[model samples]
Target chain A: DAGVTQSPTHLIKTRGQQVTLRCSPKSGHDTVSWYQQALGQGPQFIFQYYEEEERQRGNFPDRFSGHQFPNYSSELNVNALLLGDSALYLCASSLVAVSGNTIYFGEGSWLTVV
Target chain B: AQSVAQPEDQVNVAEGNPLTVKCTYSVSGNPYLFWYVQYPNRGLQFLLKYITGDNLVKGSYGFEAEFNKSQTSFHLKKPSALVSDSALYFCAVRESLEDFQKLVFGTGTRLLVSP
Candidate 1:
């Protein structure tokens, strides 16, 4: 079975430009979470989408936003991207149930903001 | 607040030797600990997890982790190391309850298994 998948494996955008990254959750997963991994650092939680709604958010600015479709697919959108926005954007999917969930990550979409 | 810590920046061990990657976590309630490995430019791969029952959890690639509640640590261990086992390892934890399951991850530790 195909695991979580992300689109635009690599992208380059000039500062102040906008970019949109897409993700399709695993076959049985209903929740999607986004993370940003900068060089020499751990992945930072961006936000989580459940039932097509944002349930939790991390320490990110208004420029970063996202949407989750009814099918549980997700898209992360960045407006007025800054040079510091360059990082590997990871999409993880999980099935939220009575038991605690275990998240599985995708290969990640690398964004380069110039 | 829930958090996780991986004290070592990197650990080097000779192939065929026992390998250990240290991890520690802090949480308000029972913790759901997890370990993941990442290769260069790739996503984190699920290694193993500790939720309930046994404290010594076995996982992929002949790796296992011991969950120490008293010390709030879940250190990854393998009996023998291989050059291919060298990669970045991450420690993460979340409240085991239905709610408050957002994962809090450590900075990660790079393990180098040299031949």
Candidate 2:
């Protein structure tokens, strides 16, 4: 049973540049959600994707976007990144069940903006 | 809207002593509460959750949480602490029937267990 997996574990980008982080949902899971965790803060919801479509989104601006593939893999893209965008991007996965849908997370990708 | 609060920034305890991390929550309807632990440079690991059922919910690594409805609190507890248990703990909640996709998390509480 593989867990959620994220790529580009660490990366650095300049301000106004764009970055994309990828994630593979846990085996047997279909829903994927993205979160941003800043220094000394909890993870903030970015958005959730199901059935290759965004089902819900957070308070993020247009600069933040994401896409989910038919295979349940996901990509989180940030355009015109700001220094404040430097944070850990976490991808979580779970089955859309009637109840008790426990979300599992990946190690997360660390994004550093300069 | 659903929200969670972890009042303590950090909690220190002896390796063999019991430990407790406090959490409170608010939601328009019944809440689905969760507890996760995160080590440095790692993602959050699910510990336990209270969707419905008995108030005491047990999770992995000998962790458990007691959900109190009247108080709107769900505090994580363990019988005896281990040095390896030192890490950041987060409390999260989502309305049971509302925006089920969004989970609101607390700022987090750091637990330090000394040997």
Query: How many Å off is the CA of B61 in candidate 2?
Result: 0.6
Q: Could you tell me every candidate's TM-score relative to the true structure? A: 0.97, 0.98
Which CAPRI tier for candidate 2? medium
* Location of the lowest summed lDDT over 10 successive residues in candidate 1 chain A: A94-103
What RMSD does model 1 have? Answer: 1.2
Candidate 2 lDDT over B1-113, as tens digits, reads 78899999999999999999999999988889999999988999999989999999999999999999999999999999999999999999988633545889999999999
Ten-residue stretch with the least lDDT total in model 2 chain B = B94-103
True-structure lDDT of candidate 1: 0.91
Interface RMSD of every predicted model, in angstroms: 1.7, 1.2
Off by over 4 Å in 1: B99-101
Compose the digit string of candidate 2's lDDT tens values, residues A1-114. Answer: 889999999999999999999999999998999999999999999999999999999999999999999999999999999999999999999888646788899999999999
- Candidate 1's displacement at residue B18, Å, is 0.7
